[model samples]
Target: MPRLLIAEDDADLGPAMKRALELDGYVVDLFARGDDVLVAVGVGSYDVILLDIGLPHMTGLEVLRALRARRDETPVIVITAFDRTPHRVAGLDAGADDYVVKPVDLEELAARIRSQLRRRERRHDDSLSVGRVTLDFAGHVASMDGEEVLLTAKEFRVLALLMRRSRRFVSKTDLEGELYDQDQWVESNTIEVAISSLRRKFGRDFIRTARGLGYMVGGLEA
Candidate 1:
């Protein structure tokens, strides 16, 4: 499931939007303060962000500016009651990927989110090959030497993150964050178990580990 963060100050509207987006097959996290949104993004990865202009602590635009300054290109959709041309332009200038005016229509918001996701996907190859293993991201399928290899949801997620960063070691903490949402309770050995399962399917050496560095798929010899 894709993860999303919503920064809206409207007490009633924020939770409502979160619930609606969850129903649309997304793991949604809601925050009323812009600073909190920044804090969440620091530790967690989100596929997209829904930011309201009128947020407490710091405004949405300020948060968006901070993200861009740090070179964080995660897609952000500005959701605000301000429908004026200046407001939209300000958001665009601040590096927002898209803007939606409030009284938000849930269906339209979902469509916009999908559009941004598709745009991001187009920036990368649909499939990645590392050694004898290949992962087709669009198809959500993994194969070894041209033969399809079945994988559970968790296994696929772990493999995808590793393969995407094929050259770098991915820490267990990063893997756990990607696998489970903020609200989900995770077992300490969850990532270890998943890695063990993946090694069984692909050869034991398919994923290499280094002390203190975490795991990697390809690049340097193990």
Candidate 2:
């Protein structure tokens, strides 16, 4: 699950947005004050942030500025009622990854969030290959011997993490951390099941299971 931080001051809209995003499979932390946003972003590893401009105390622009000044590159979508040219330009200039004018369309907002997360994933794809198999982390794609191999969402997440750390053991605990959010109740065999699925798609040798160290892509010898 992707983590999101929402900085909107509206009592009604803030919780509404949070519920909508959580329903869309995001773990969201919401703040009604702009000053609190800076602190939240500084500590949490969020995939995206939804910031409202007309926030109390500090403005959203100031929070955005503080984030960028610290060299934090987390994707931000400035959400505000202000659709004015100057406001939009200022948010963009402050390093927002995207912007949306409120009365926000939740569907459109969800799509934009997905877009930003996809871009972030693509940057980290970096062509992880082992033997004849290649994993495209960003595209949620994998290919073997120049052919596309379909994978389930959980399968893809498992494979991507393993391939990113190819030839290195990925313990069950570490894999679980990446695959599920804190609120998600992971089954004891969840990783095992996803691995089993991947093995079916890529053959047994494609992913090696060490006796105790855990799962790895191919093998160190490959």
Candidate 3:
């Protein structure tokens, strides 16, 4: 099972999030203090770390800075109730993979977690590209027509998965878990909907569907 570290100060919310993620099949370690988090991170094999901005002993931002200073590339996502642009900017610049302003919807938070994990996986892949779409695994971004195509968090993840294995069918269930919690109960068409939306944002020809299989993004009909 995947391991996750949740650094949250709220007595109630922290455990709440842990319970939710644990039932989703992740082995979660919850910490209410930043100093403890720092210590634990240095010694633990964490696949994902869900951090809150407010923390005792050390600020969450301080912990994040400390982790990045040591070149820890483990995905750290800041989940805070504060929705300020300056704070968000600081978190990303400090090496956070993503941020969520609370009170978070459990389903959405799970989706964000799935997206970050998949994104990290894509980084270690050799390379990903299809048609005009060029994905830089090292740089962690996608491009088309020589322009950096702006993609939402979910869009980038979904596109990366398909482009990494171009000409292959990706089933909805395969995508479902990677984009949501196991108990989040997304509709079967959730993958289809997300893909359809992405197709419109990009170009319809960019993604192809194989009736009973799933979706593919790459190459031409020829």
- State the lDDT of candidate 2 residue by residue for 1-222, as single tens digits: 788999998999999999999998899999999889876765345778999988899999998988776656678999989888998899999999899998999999999999999987776655556667777766768898889998877787788788666546789998998877642778889999999888888888878787878888745234
Q: Write the per-residue lDDT of candidate 3 for residues 8-120, one digit (tens) a residue.
A: 98988999999999999999999999999977865455778999989989988999998776656678989888898999998999889999999978999999999988986
Candidate 1 segments whose C-alpha is farther than 4 A from its true place: 126-222
Report model 1's TM-score to 2 decimal places: 0.62
Candidate 1: Cα lDDT at 11 = 82
| Better by lDDT, candidate 2 or 1 | 1
Residue 63, candidate 2: Cα error in Å is 0.4
**Model 2 lDDT-worst window of ten:** 213-222
Q: Which 10 successive residues of model 1 have the least lDDT summed?
A: 213-222
Query: In model 2, which residue pairs have backbone atoms overlapping below 3 Å?
Result: none
